[model samples]
Target: MTEDRPSTVGVLLAGGLARRMGGGDKPMKTIGGRTILERVIAQLAPQCDGLILNANGDPARFAVFGLPVVADTVEGFAGPLAGVLTALDWAAEHRPDVEWVLSAATDCPFLPRDLVERLQRARIAEDAQLAVAASGDQTHPVIGLWNVALRSDLRHALVIEDMRKIDRWTARYKLAKVTWPDKPIDPFFNANTVEDVAKAEQLAALDGA
Candidate 1:
């Protein structure tokens, strides 16, 4: 990790219900002969100081990856914001040296290799409170950089304010939006269904996976 940039812990958000993918761990599904979670890890591991998985239910299912699995602090299957909060809290407690948490959905197999570097750079350049990734005119709130210091504020938003929308919460802060080219393939393409997984298989070849 670069000494100048704030230390960041990568958080793979696997807490989704995956209803569209037939109600199972979508990240565990295979793409290009490897699990999507595996692909996500391969892409993100090198960019962050450390990595952890935000997953609910029995943690044993993810033991093979050897990542520390943390369940959302809030109950009732809160949305992606909860996963973000979990990561921020985890980094604050488990990795005190880490000032930031980079959150990404586990289903995204083609996450950008320069994700951490770019997001950090953008946040610093804009002097923003948060930084998020965008592609082809769409912003991906779930895939972004978060400050560990915002854990309490996020928890209050989730528990007290009942804020489930990520965009709504992020709107409160000065957010740096960094857009990436969609040509060749969108770096943030995620597998949300069986068909998407098939598409990812083809895209994986293009990604040189």
Candidate 2:
């Protein structure tokens, strides 16, 4: 319950079925000899005090990751905003000291290393309610830092207003975007399909040079 790194819990939204790559967990897919989830968790673990995986059913498959598995509070696949909202609830109950929760999808293995620190800095500097990352003029709403206090408002909006896109809720509150240089044009890349997997492998090889 202290304002320390342990207060923040990194939430991995891993419930997606890789429709583009047939119908299975994309996190389980490999690139450059590591599963996407493995690569992502390695980068994410060092940035937070604790971590949890948000996905539906059969959490045993992800047991090797050694993080708690949570399911959506709402039943109908309401999208990433619902996942974010679920994470807020988890943060509230478990990591009470954490004023914010940092979240991202499992498929974005190349997420920035200083992701949590940068988003926190931006939120404080801009005095905003929400903070998300930007790369090469593209804003990633899923990779975000959210104030835990917004849980009630988000729930009300979802339940009553039937809002879906994260941007719609973000727009209602003050938001700040922290842009990362994409000179190599790689910060926000995601591996969503077999082609993307191949491209990511190639990009990683190039980046290692």
Candidate 3:
């Protein structure tokens, strides 16, 4: 990201039910002796001007992390789109100078360092309203760059139309898909199960080296 027009804030989408992981904050699980949320923050904090965490129910559980915990503005847990809308509304109201909000899952420990830079480059180059990250052939819809200008439409989709799927909403606009190599580790690999957490621990060793 360039300093010129790269004014972006970050929103960690932590509001997952985690039924596959036994129903708890999967991000709180440890990998390489650090919480996945910690690892996510470390990777994203430097790349963003500011950061916030999006989680539903008991914001107190995330207080120790020291980032503002935002909940879905729309009712009935409207999925990642609600989280993205929350981020956009927050950024629009609080960070007026920030034009873009980068949304990444909290459970992903190996997020790329160049995520923001590359996403910004792709969106700007393509003159796109949104940009999403992809690893090889897998696209991470929850992890993307959202323009603050679309917050109104997003809120409408979530609250009025009850839209939940991210791709469905993104399909309505110009979207840029930015791809990253899935080499030693996939940057968007998330810990959704106990087995995945174990795998992340092994990958953490590779990452530390």
Tens digits of per-residue lDDT for model 3 on 1-209? Answer: 47434889999998879989999998899998889999999999999999999999999999999999999888887788989999999998999999999999998999999899999988989989999999989999999999999999998888889888999999999999999999889999988999999998999898782
Q: For residues 1-209, what per-residue lDDT tens digits would candidate 2 score against the true structure?
A: 22322256789998776689887898998878889899889998888888889998799999998999998887787778778889999989988878888889899868888888888777877778888998888899999888899999999888889899888889998898989987684677888889998888888777861
Could you tell me every candidate's TM-score relative to the true structure?
0.97, 0.94, 0.96
- Model 2: how far residue 194 lies from native, Å: 1.2
lDDT of 3: 0.91
RMSD to truth, every model = 1.1, 2.0, 1.3
Global lDDT of each candidate: 0.91, 0.84, 0.91
Residue-pair clashes, model 2: 1
Screening candidate 3 with a backbone cut-off below 3 angstroms (N, C-alpha, C), the clashing residue pairs are: none
- Tens digit of per-residue lDDT, candidate 1, span 40-126: 999999998889999999999999999999999899999889889988888888888888999999988888899999999999988
Ten-residue region with minimum lDDT total, candidate 1: 1-10
Highest TM-score, which number?
1
